[model samples]
Target: MKAVEYRLPKEFDKSFIVFKEQGLYFPCPWHYHPEYEFVLVNKSSGRRMVGDHIGTFLEGDLVLMGPSLPHVWVNDQKYFEKENTETADAVVVHFLKDFLGENFFNLPESEPLKKILNLSNRGLVILGHTRYQITKIMNAMPRQNGLKRLSSLFEIFDILANSSEYELLASPSYMENTRDMYSDRFSKITEYILRNFHRDITLKEVADQANMATTTFCNFFKEHFRMTFVEYLNAIRIGHVCKLLADRDKTIISVAYECGFNNLANFNRQFKRLKDMTPKEYRKALEAEPMIA
Candidate 1:
């Protein structure tokens, strides 16, 4: 997919940009920049694309991405409805590798920090205690400026440097071959899928969205997504279905239909293939736990 370039606003007084974002829809689009990014989503639920990785993102999501890594978080359909008042809120930090100094990370004391920055080129999701700690710091970032804010940035870095509670998002292959796909129609195709995935979607329809033949588009999608188009769509649907299953008021059949499954039998089969459990069993498991998906 061709990713768009995003220009982060300049702030000469600050060593890096740390700010809060709040809007009916996230101001972000599918784009990239030259600086590394730290994003913490305090309020929002949506689909996030990091390089070639596409997955569900919910409130409290935290991700770190290296320079020029293409990514975006597309808000769910509910955020787009005229009647919905909920806003997408996040704290984002952007800084260059040498924002501290040209050779700061090269110092012996900064080995761990250097290591994580290398890993972030593929994008990383900060998780567990690390996520919680970082979330607290991100919330206080805007309220504190100058040296205090800079120190908080270091505090987050130290947590990341020592902790193993994280996962890489994009594949090594995607990072290595980004030059070849820099100008692509993949983003256009994904936007179409996000808008229509609540109902049936076909390969032919997606191919048309990309203005490519079905066969050609399928091959390209598999290379970037690590799965076929149908596999990707079902994965997205099942993600939402899991959330719906948490609601005891909705029958499993209704949940499946709402998530785009027309055939009950097919839905059951697909659900099992992905989650290793049938829809009814999955519902029962969640109902017992009493937690949101």
Candidate 2:
């Protein structure tokens, strides 16, 4: 997708911005900015797209993204319903590499921080105990001002710099050229796929969305997603299927059809291809050893 560039609102007295943002759901677009961002998803469940990667996120999702790294958090459809009452909230911090001073982080004392900041170009997901510790600090940032706020930020960075409990999002190829030439063309197609993946989506349909010939679109889809269009769509459908399997109340066959699978045989085949297990086996494992988080 082509990420729209945004200039974050600024305050006269502060070189960075930090606060608690709350709303019915995240209203941000698929966008990027010059400033580095640290976001702690204090409350919400959604799918998060970072660069060319897409995955699910739940409460306590903490990530740090470097400048110009495209990203967005789209809440589940329920949050957007007019009658829904749940709120989405997060602690968002934005700053520039030179926010303090161009040479401040270059000092010998800041080597670790500089190293991690450089790695943030790929986007980092905070995990383990470090995630919880930083969550507390981020939750407290909005109430402080002046030097106190800056101090808390530095503390968070120090922890992140020393920690290995984190995973990098986005592929090396995507990060090498953050702005893909065909990005603008892909945006419309990505939106169409996400919205319609629950149903049968044909090659001609998606090709029309991209305004390209079917053959050309086939090559383009493979290049962009490193998978055939059908493989990509099935991956999306399977991702949602895994989530539904967590709730055993629904029958496996019903869950398969609800997620757009037309036949039980094909659904079972695809499910195993992606998850390395059948839907029933996946559910049985979940029941035996449920995730604590």
Candidate 3:
């Protein structure tokens, strides 16, 4: 089935809008819109889906999603149970890419904002102190008016555009799938892979899903993604491994196997190739960094 579901704001009097939502859970379904969105999960834990990427999001999760990038935060099953009393809350800011003016982003001084908007096509998870700062700004946006609101918005963009502590959410290939057919096909491929990547996967099986021969699929994937199928699979596995590593209780070897690596040697090789460090080293780096609330 096609995955792109279009969405629109409640009204259209302004170019920029902020929405505060608090409910039993986040109400949006899997959908996309023309305006870019900055979302802060003020209070809740859930599975966040952005483009082809999937991961758990806890309270304080902050993300910037580019225009037309599909996303949703599905609360955990526990949140939906009748006995559950917790609610989900979020602050969302939506603005068009050219909210300032048609030529705004084209100006020399706007280069950084342009780069950030371009990068957001893949979605971005704002991190560390930047995320905390953004939360403060977002919370204050509704109370401010006129130039103050505009200036704060610019500040938010500036911080996000220049920050190093952010993670790209989706693969470049998935974000670049613009054609209807190609978009649907890639979405299917990604959903399948994310669901089954923990198990062994073969090029032959994925090619069959794409309705192409193995060699044809190989060439097609590499041409569009600039990475071989094996490379892409390894990248996905490594991403999951990174998340797993955050849990101090899980051993590195166990995390490797759980992420679909059959052997520690291959896992370490791929991890170093993609992450530039071994699993243990990555864990050490995480521990070394001061925890941000």
Per-model tally of clashing residue pairs: 1, 0, 0
lDDT of 3 by residue, 196-232 (tens): 8888999999988888899998998897556898888
| lDDT winner between candidates 2 and 3 | 2
Per-prediction TM-score to the true structure, in the order listed? 0.61, 0.61, 0.62
lDDT scores in order = 0.79, 0.79, 0.78
Residue 100, model 3, lDDT: 78
lDDT (C-alpha) at residue 188 in model 2: 78
Off by over 4 Å in 2: 176-293
Output candidate 1 Cα RMSD.
Answer: 12.6
Instruction: Give per-residue CA lDDT, model 2, range 257-280, as digits (tens).
Output: 988999889999988876666788
Query: How do the residues 1-293 of candidate 1 rate in per-residue lDDT, one tens digit apiece?
Result: 34578877867789899888899978666688999899999998987767645567999999999898878887887988999989999999999878889989878889878778877887899889999999999899998978999999999989899998998776443333233233458667766776787898889989998989989998989986668998888877776687677678888888889989998888888888866668777666444311211
* Model 2 per-residue lDDT at 49: 66
In the order shown, what is each candidate's alpha-carbon RMSD?
12.6, 12.3, 11.1
Candidate 2 has what TM-score? 0.61
Q: Whole-model lDDT, candidate 3?
A: 0.78
